[model samples]
Target: MFYFSICFMFFIILFLMSFFLFILSIIFLMMDMVYFFEWELVSLNSSSIVMTFLFDWISLLFMSFVLLISSVVIYYSKEYMSEDFNINRFIMLVLMFVFSMMLLIISPNLISILLGWDGLGLVSYCLVIYFQNVKSYNAGMLTALSNRIGDIALLLAIAWMLNYGSWNYIFYLEISKNHMEMMIIGGLVMLAAMTKSAQIPFSAWLPAAMAAPTPVSALVHSSTLVTAGVYLLIRFNFLLVDSILGKILLLISGLTMFMAGLGANYEFDLKKIIALSTLSQLGLMMSILSMGFLKLALFHLLTHALFKALLFMCAGSIIHNMKNNQDIRLMGNLVTQMPLTSSCFNLANLALCGMPFLAGFYSKDLILEIVMLSYMNLFSFFLYFFSTGLTVCYSFRLIYYTLSGNYMGSSFHLMSDESWVMLSGKFVLLFMSIIGGSLLSWMIFPISTMICLPFYLKMLTLMVCIVGGVMGYTISLVSLMYFNKTLNLYKMSFFLGLMWFMPLISTVGILNPFLFLGNFVFKSFDQGWSEYFGGQVLYKNLKFNSLMMQMFQFNNLKIYLMSLVLWLIILISLLMI
Candidate 1:
């Protein structure tokens, strides 16, 4: 326990240092100076592979938030994971994850970025499977492999960068602007980002990754793994700006946001609902980024990290008190039993729903406003607004099921906010959920946004929030009366509940075909034909020759004499010819 406390304190100190650095970075940004440091690692044929770090307000600010949240998570885990024998290992894995994220944040060179990218995937896989359960194992594999696709795409991008002299893509962005090679690199980078960010087809892994420990989920879904993709695109936005691929990315991200928002409404698991929300927010970031709003995306990313992490921590507290029951269906009247947690949970949910003055409002509402102002096709326009409404829809639904309904759990359970460590973390984040967005907006975007729109367009987001919230609450009330009645929308519910069957498509439709092909190859080519022809036939021939030699041993001299005479006769015939 003392050792864990020491580790927690160490992280807290690191986070403080990062916060100071972030302030310094802002000062530097204002002064028009950005820091760049590089060390040459290898040079071949005029192309140099260098490790490079870039320090600007964006990277520093993001790093500060990541460290801050990570510190809180570690502190929270000291209590959350106290009973687990391997708590130290879990903490260390999280620390490594943080370090990897920092590496990724600072790296300007694509070659060096791979170090952090691969490290994230590797460490996240370890964290996801920390419980050593079958579910965790499967989730870890899905998460790892899904992210691996992005890793490969990044590697391909790096390979393509070899066409230029240096792997330092930052230096080359302007020089190679709109070049075919650069476009290819941009396309590959977007694909990589998609995999990491859980956009569309790769989105299945995010919800499934809820099998990880709740703390890990909080870190991963909030600030670290899923956000890596958005950050990557943000870094590469110079090249992606106004590119055809960027428009395509916009469409896909919009769809992903809508998909995840709908999925959350049907999800039952507490953590999964939050996970899907993270996915939805990720889509928002990606879509906004695709519109070339890099700073806006970064702003939302930071704020989302704050409230989402807080939400997860609150969820963790509830799950702990509930003895690991995650189904919101079985959770009710938590407000009466665990007032503090319930309050924090409701606050975070409101933040998630983009309530007027909360953290989410500063970013999410602004994002919606920006989307409405942008020139977009009908499909994208509809997706953006509908997805925004769905955020409110699922959030209110979640609030009703968990906080306001009748007590649905066993009466023997005792719930309270006695854990100081956990409460401390939640309180810190709760304060942030209220003010983090407003604070960050002031710090990151000093100039306020200027929008020229009609009154209805301005009130569009507020109206959607109201309608969605009312519908969600009314549906939750209706659910109780019809609790035992068969839901006619079971098919639709099942589809949305299962993330539009993406997990099924990824695991069954996508993976099963390859699995079947592998089995067929192994059976027909490897075990059947290859085995019989190569190994079996060779063995049979060798055995036959050996047996024949054994039969004609020294004891069988007549056979040896006959073979010699036959050879001699063939030699004489050749000589005469």
Candidate 2:
């Protein structure tokens, strides 16, 4: 009961704070006003401890977006979770999640960031497991363990910073530029960011995290948990660009982008499709951030937040109307029933595919053009464009499955766009999805970027997107008659569909060997050799010795003779010594 009121309180406070922060962010942008707060905690000997908060245009703008999205997400969750008995607890968890994100958003010190970092991981685990199912439990563990790696990395970075006698990483960009310790710290931070953002070798948890409620998915995937890594890297971009770690991140992020898009095409779950799309966009942000486009990365990050949130909210609406059925195979002609949601979904999908003048287009198109103009190797160039096509491929494939077919859901389903609370949450982001990109592009870049490329090169994005759309339409046209042929190619399809077995490689693939080793150790040491030779062996020897002594004390002739002989032998041995 109180949770609902508190949620409303948070929504109002965050919305108001977001408004003022955006204005202040613009002021900081225009007037170059950077504010830092350092509170002295204590003085010990010659050193002092302080709590630091940094307020600059970058942190402020990010905070504004985080708060704004969180407000809408909380609003959306009201209708979505209303039926659940644990709705109050859900609201509380969501509030904690939002608070942790704000803490992470404004901190310049690694020590303070770790508090928020660990909070995000812990709160997200709670939210992921809120369903009280085995699947949710496993997903929660995976999410927690995967994020723990980044938390440890941040801890190491903080420990490593001790050499410099300060935790304020903002102040060391120039001093630690070329130092060896800084290189190690940079690598650790990159590893942290990669794990948090679900980059290659650590991406299995993102889609699996779809076990969470749809509203949590919208919040976590869009603007909170997944983006934390990208934001961390954005803060450390100066150390990443042109470094070895940056080059590696560029390649890995490109691969992650490709893999996510490919996996989404083969996915059947509606929510997971969106999850993979989020992963792909995260890869985009990370790739460009590695390429030294921090502003472009932030621009896309903000714009992506708007549409992706809207996308997931629409997804939540459809999922609810379908009676919690998330399989797209059961969802068709949804556009005819839930017109508003379908429209929002289609708009978000188009924005994701980088439709011209939409949110994704402004950032995605610019990123592609910049990649085209940058002198890069052929491999990186192919990855950039091909991944873009894959994004559209999945987007169109999803569109065809969900919106274009005859009604395939249950006949009893009362599918409609009647949830005003949910719709209200969506419309704000929907408006932003259309207008936020252009506005951000204007505000983020006071001076527009200048680029010139050949016409064919400039049109490459449209060309690939067209090809992908056609492919998607054709792929979705595969009727039941063609199901047998896919089985023939099941091996290849399974590999591609399952993220190239990275999930296997990340999950059971990693745990099995360690589990086997642990079993072996338990058997041989705790129950086998050590069991036989340890305490039992010592007790057995002592018992046998005591029994032999008892035998000698028996007062029989043979026993006395044996004891006398043994005693004579011992005395002679002592005399010789």
Question: Which ranges of candidate 2 are over 4 A from the true structure?
Answer: 1-6, 43-47, 479-481, 515-577
Residue pairs with clashing backbones, model 2: none
Candidate 1 structure quality by residue, lDDT tens digits, 221-339: 88898999999999889876788988899989998999999988888899998998998899999999999999899999999999999999999999999899998988988898888
Q: On a 0 to 100 scale, what is the lDDT of residue 140 in model 1?
A: 91
Q: Over the stretch 1-577, how does candidate 2's per-residue lDDT look in tens digits?
A: 6656766777788889998999999999999989999988998997888889999999999889888999988888877888888887888898899889889988999999999999999999999999999999989988888888888898999999999978888999867778888889889999999998999999999998999999899999888999999999898888887789889999999999999989998889999999999999999999999999999999999999999999999999988988899999888888889999999999999999999999999999999999999978899899898989999988988888899888787778788888898898899899999999999889988797688999999999999988988887787777433877778877877888899898788778875676688899999999889868898888999999999888767778987887799999999999999
RMSD of 1: 3.6
Indicate which candidate wins on lDDT.
Answer: 2
After superposition, candidate 1 runs with Cα above 4 Å error: 41-49, 519-574
Candidate 2 scores a C-alpha RMSD against the true structure in Å of 5.3
Model 2 residue 431 CA deviation (Å) reads: 0.4
- Against the reference, the lDDT scores of all candidates come to 0.88, 0.90
* Total colliding residue pairs, candidate 2: 0
